[model samples]
Target chain A: MADFSLFSRRFDVKRVPGFASVALGVFVMLYMPVILLVVYSFNKGTNLAFWEGFSLRWYVQAYHNEAVQEAAFRSLYLALIAATLATTAATMAALATTRTKKFRGQMLIYTLINQPLMVPEIVTAVALLIFFAMIKVATGHTGMIYLIVAHTAFCIPFAYLPIRARLESMDLTLETAAADLYASPWMTFRRVTLPLMWPGIVAGLMLAFVVSLDDVVITEFVKSAGQETLPTFMLGQLRRVVTPEVNAISTVLMAVSVIFVAMFFVLTGRKN
Target chain B: MIEIRNITKVFGAGEHAVTALQEINVNIAENEFFTLLGPSGCGKTTLLRLIAGFEHPSTGSMLLAGEDISLLPPNKRPVNTVFQNYALFPHMTVAGNIAFGLEMLGRPKAEVAETVDRMLRLVRMEELKNRQTSEISGGQQQRVALARALAPQPKVLLLDEPLSALDLKLRKEMQIELKRLQSETGITFVFVTHDQEEALTMSDRIAVMNAGRIHQIGSPRQIYDHPENRFVANFIGDSNFLNAKLGNIKDDQAELEFAAGRKVTVPLHRADLSDGEVSVLIRPEHVSIAEPTGNSHELTGVIENIVYFGTDTHYHLKLASGEAFMARLQNNPSEAEKRAAGDKVAVLMDAKAIQILRD
Candidate 1:
């Protein structure tokens, strides 16, 4: 009937000139390397730079390699422990920050809880490396606990954000209603708050798990001599040899992180 | 029964302090439906929160059935509230929500189930017992909230504008339902609402509040028929305020001289009555258009506007003194001849219906 559009078609982000090509350019810039890596992972040739015929040779080799198996197991174990610990601490922090009435220094508390996310990853890695180095020299013990603790600390903010959002969206009066019905604080949290924020918690847990699983910087710096996670092992392997087996391990890791991230978005995007 | 003695609530501290309620003293009798009636931000909800144990008074104490409950937490108090937004737990079924309070009180499984069944029957929500609270309509959620609050069998039930979220028809229905539940359960109800009609219709006694003070406290009829001051009179209903000159005061009556030299005798309810310069309040329904042969007691005014409300018609009039007045007349076939706008009419006020209000 009538054109009531506020801006001309040229101003529309999707309809602007070269929008599709620019979008394609961005996609290629972001994903072309990963796509090439994945493509070469199926190559029958030993070189990662050239793809010969299609084959699952590297996938089979990655599956059978003892170093790959051990690093994969270590990555999964570290992610499980770190994600669980981070989610627990994040849930408590989210509740403390969202449930109580506004007090002095609340903004400061928020910034402190999210310190890792705000600071550069390299800075955190160096800080943790130096801090843990002293403890290693003092106790003469260097175990996976250092890596788990570092990863958990880094994942706290990732887990905290989604849970805090969920807590803030929740109706405060529901908790009041629970208390009005003679429910103690613990009972109210268990019966009302916990059940309602379960989706956000699950989303946060998945996000933290994915974050811990794919982390390379902190793991590289904090890990001991022999305790190489999957990512660190792949990094060492790349220095020694240019092979598609590392590409295969990377594709598997990418697949896992994508699945978990998809699930995270689904959970957090839920209306209720 | 609950007693609030010299209760005052002040929010914040030092320079930012705000007095929400000041020197409030009210004693609610057992099983009586007492209402805290006021506009929003007038501290009505604050008073209700104090009584529900959600907030402790900044000063003074509260007693529930002769026991001091001033320091008790909300969970420790034997009271429940139906929040304004219903606040139904979205994760729980209706029956589960209704049964939660009992389970928390350490009631036996059989008793909790029986109580939940009874409450569901009480609120007529049996069909939606298994449904999640998020799936229910607003009215149904309101009922579930009521049932959940009442299932605890508290000594008193506090409702903080619980019907405000429902549509008009549902609000009316729930008003009647709330009144019925109050009487049937024999528990005291403390309801808070800004709607004057709802307060007048359901309250056994109403405490009209304003600016952190209780202006008046009485039965509905007493508050409506004999409001103590200007705020209560203006807040409860429509009124025509006229400047009158007080002549003489008897034991409980006074003579008021209005415009057009119309003098009428009115009952004096307040002890602050003076000899000159007073305001007189007359309800629209109490004033009528006088016939052509009206005498000295009639006031001369021109009809400014006529608003027809199906059941009744309100005639807006401008008096000879340039003051505005309204007269409501019921629409009946056998009534007097209809007066149009710009028509001159003699206004006759019932002497006893005129109320003397303090400034």
Candidate 2:
């Protein structure tokens, strides 16, 4: 017997089984590659194979390689700078776009800002190469500056999406109340809006950092000399020869990336 | 402490132009609790925004403390608003929320802490200082909003239906608390509310607005006893509008001729009565079931329906002239209750209690 009333509906008791099967399928598909990577990272075999024996030799090798270590450090350095600059600019853009009434070119500016999100990464890479070549031809300052610029531009739309979402979710009344309480604009942003917006900024920073760190196409097009990020360095290595050391470095990169992502989730979880 | 002169807010323009507020002029003293009472879309909130410095007037100037603050940003003005949703910062604790404004002023640590403590105590929320804002209850959130707004020590506190979010019992409790807080703080409180009972019970002076204009402004008793126009009379409280004509005026009493070809003397609020069609307004409570007495006008009607509520009884009656009337009677069994469904009843009202209004 069914209790057909307005107060009662078809509840999750009947729907959970279907949802569970779909969720289980999704989890299996996503986790299989990750599981394989983790399992192979511990393998003692020279070739990546079914587990022969467990050993910490690859981890040791990854830590000991000077080239690998240098590449990793360079990637981190560029990512930190890129993430900071990109997230700052994105936060500003998000604040402007999300919190204001319509103005001339606002919709156009919004579309332009998010254009990088839709356009292929290779297209952006080519576009950056062309733009920097023009800048290089004009100013004759061709160096890592172009690479940083390209990387930051690519990371901005990503960071902007999350930060803008956070800003939009926040109540407009709190800032208005802050203003009413005699707080100056700068003070209100620093105290009320900033603390409230911290999680979004952090999440955006982490995401931008990871994107910049992992990007190979933009770095390949923009880098002139001695400006190879870790992903580009890894690409160069893979083109030359395959090594157990390469797998080890890949595992290390994955680990560090996972840690940063976990930290992002932890901080952002407070809002939920 | 506030004077608004011909303030208006026009939203958009051209094909989408909408006038949100008309020429609104109002004055509030230093410690009076003024309320803008109306239904939704009556421009009450828009008027509040104009006074709060959030929205600049499209025309005319607003003066606070005799200074034109019409062009000032909200941060530059000494006015705080408790929003309808309370709008407490979820990131901050109650104490942190209270201290944020003072911190923005670059106040010293000890002074800010002391002020925050004082405000928490003022709202009787000192015990919840350490709790996260979201962890606290809604009532506590509202108190935190008050404490935070008051920490800056603004000249006025604007509340936008601050109690509309609460349940019935809690709403009653908060209304009393808010009135008491207003008296204690001596800060000018400008409240906007749609609930007429809330406006009548809590306000020192109520301004009833409709269609972007002030319909009437008076104390609760004045608005209830004497509404200036038909809209104010209908909106402020319940009224049975009986079609009547003004024949002549003698002192406070005026002649009201009903459609049944009977003339009765009724009280007129204004000294000057323009000769034409007018409506005679009488509250449900004022129309009694007693028989005709001295200085009373009597009418015979058949009771169409009688609704017995727990606290009060309602009688729906139809007169001989085909006009309908309703009367709310307080439940009392000691006096012989004469009204029942389809029973013949005589509705009586004194001449002094009648109000003449527009057609």
Candidate 3:
């Protein structure tokens, strides 16, 4: 009884019974479907509700399917290019907003950068579709470039938020001291500002990569025919048939996102 | 040497404008340890910033070594500042921070390393050269800041209350250390501090400022001993201001009659005294408690309160005319001379020690 009491006191399990129940309910509501989908991805039978003997047939099918392979490659390539472009642009925006004194229209620029996160995703997708159609008409070029541009635009705000937060929290006295010590503005940024803000840059890049990797609506609207990313491909598969191959592909993508998020946390967590 | 001429700094414009500095003019000689001393918000820091080229004056020019540097930016100027909070680079090691300025100037790596080592030894942090700035103590970080600012050997070094963040003992230690460093390096140091004692102890000459204007500029003794006005007299040290009427104005001395009709002659430090109402200033240390000598120059007062400091004691006295004043005496008073509350004592003012000022 004493050991039980000590354990209860240490864990405080009895004090937050209502909180524990709500948390349990929320976890079940959020992750149970994902868990079920993952479990069905290993199912040997076609029925998603009832689990059959476990097998790796769907994984093998996902791996071997040429369309799946092509879509996966396209998504990976698009996410990589989009995340890089967004991270670079967001970094410049963060530095401009946080490092300098307030100028005219600074608040407007900040609001504009964050507009994509505020507006509905479908509205943004339609706007991008119209904008890219004009660009395509003018340039006569419509390939992965449209999808990359759309993804990059959507990912900018996601990248900007964390990078801006990091820049705001940074001690600006170091830069001033650098300037006082005969460093030009460019040298100070390269040596002091860049090194200190590296973690934020990496975290922003990973967040943008994860966000762009899972996007389906924007990719569907902006991408031309024969340019189906993995998410859009999965959406098409779900519309036509109910199969475990889509679940397998989703599980792989989810695993990749989880890995990137975990890496993001690790990179941003360490103190310099 | 830095020459400042009619510099004025204003923040904002029109109705919202605040005058941070007003027509400041001073010349700081080369290798001089000059201090800008004032209360907070008095624009001492603004003057220091103007000299450092961090701020440009609104109405005047600043010349450094006879070259007009009024429009030059801080990086282009031959000056560096030790910030109030030390502001050492959190990401760099002690040696790395000290070597930063030399490296910025594109010096040879071997010379940069040598200068870093020399600066580390100068601050007596040779063993902590490899330590990160955040890993060290406040005092250590302060030394690193000084070393980093001094590494490039700029013509002028600006210190913005660099010792204000340290503990009391460490502050005292650094006060002496800073004075030694200033003299040893022979660099023109323009230090800004609100601490009066620090200004007195560290600076060769002090510029006392108040309300965005420089009130007086003199040596420490001159500032303390012979302040020009009521503000300087009260700001630098403990002073007792007595209302008086000027009776006779002579070449070397003046006769001042107190409120109680008692008259005394005071040495004239300034030549602008007229024959009307005046203010007589005397330091608390100059007022001595003694028995009634039946002299008209002495003031009879009753002790109101006695504050016993370890080294000295302050006796708050109420004069016969109901005016209150303080007299500070060394603690080594004879037992017979020790007077408590309600004791009647004659306050003696040395003729030379009493200062006469205009209203």
Best by DockQ: 1
Ranking of all candidate structures by their TM-score, best first: 1, 3, 2
* TM-score of chain B taken alone, candidate 2: 0.94
Candidate 1 Cα lDDT to native: 0.92
User: DockQ of candidates 1 onward, in order?
Assistant: 0.83, 0.65, 0.68
TM-score of candidate 1 chain B vs. the reference: 0.96
Among all windows of 10 consecutive residues in model 1 chain A, the one with the lowest summed lDDT is A4-13
Question: Each candidate's iRMS in angstroms?
Answer: 0.8, 1.6, 1.2
For model 2, chain A alone compared with the true chain A gives a TM-score of 0.85
Residues B1-359, candidate 1, lDDT per residue (tens digit)?
Answer: 89999999999999999999999999999999999999899999999999888899999999999999998999999999999998888888999999989999999999999999999999999999999888989999999999999998999999999998888999899999999999999999999999999999999999999999999999999999988888999999998888889978998888888965688777777877779888878899987786545576668888999998889999999987899999998889887446778888888766888888887
lDDT of 3 by residue, B1-359 (tens): 99989989998899999999998989999999999999999999988888777778999999999999999878898899999987787788999999999999999999999999999999999999899888999999999999999999999999999998999999999999998899899999999999999999889999999999999999999999988889999889899988888867889777888885578877788887788887778899987888777776667888999998888889999888888899998887465345779998888767888887655
Where's the lowest-lDDT run of ten residues in candidate 1 chain B?
A: B290-299
Task: Tell me the tens digit of each residue's lDDT in model 2 across B1-359.
Answer: 99989988899989998998888889988999999999899999999888888889999898999999999998788888888998887778899888877887779999999999999889999788899988988888888888887888888889988898889998999999888888888899999999999999999999999999998788999999888778888998888877877777778776788763457777667876776678777898897775434332457677899888878888898886889888988887775456557776778777776787744
- Put the candidates in lDDT order, highest first: 1, 3, 2
What's the lDDT for residue B286 in model 2?
90
Residue pairs with colliding backbones in model 1 are none
DockQ of 2: 0.65
Q: Is the docking of candidate 2 incorrect, acceptable, medium or high quality?
A: medium
Which candidate model has the greater lDDT, 1 or 2?
1
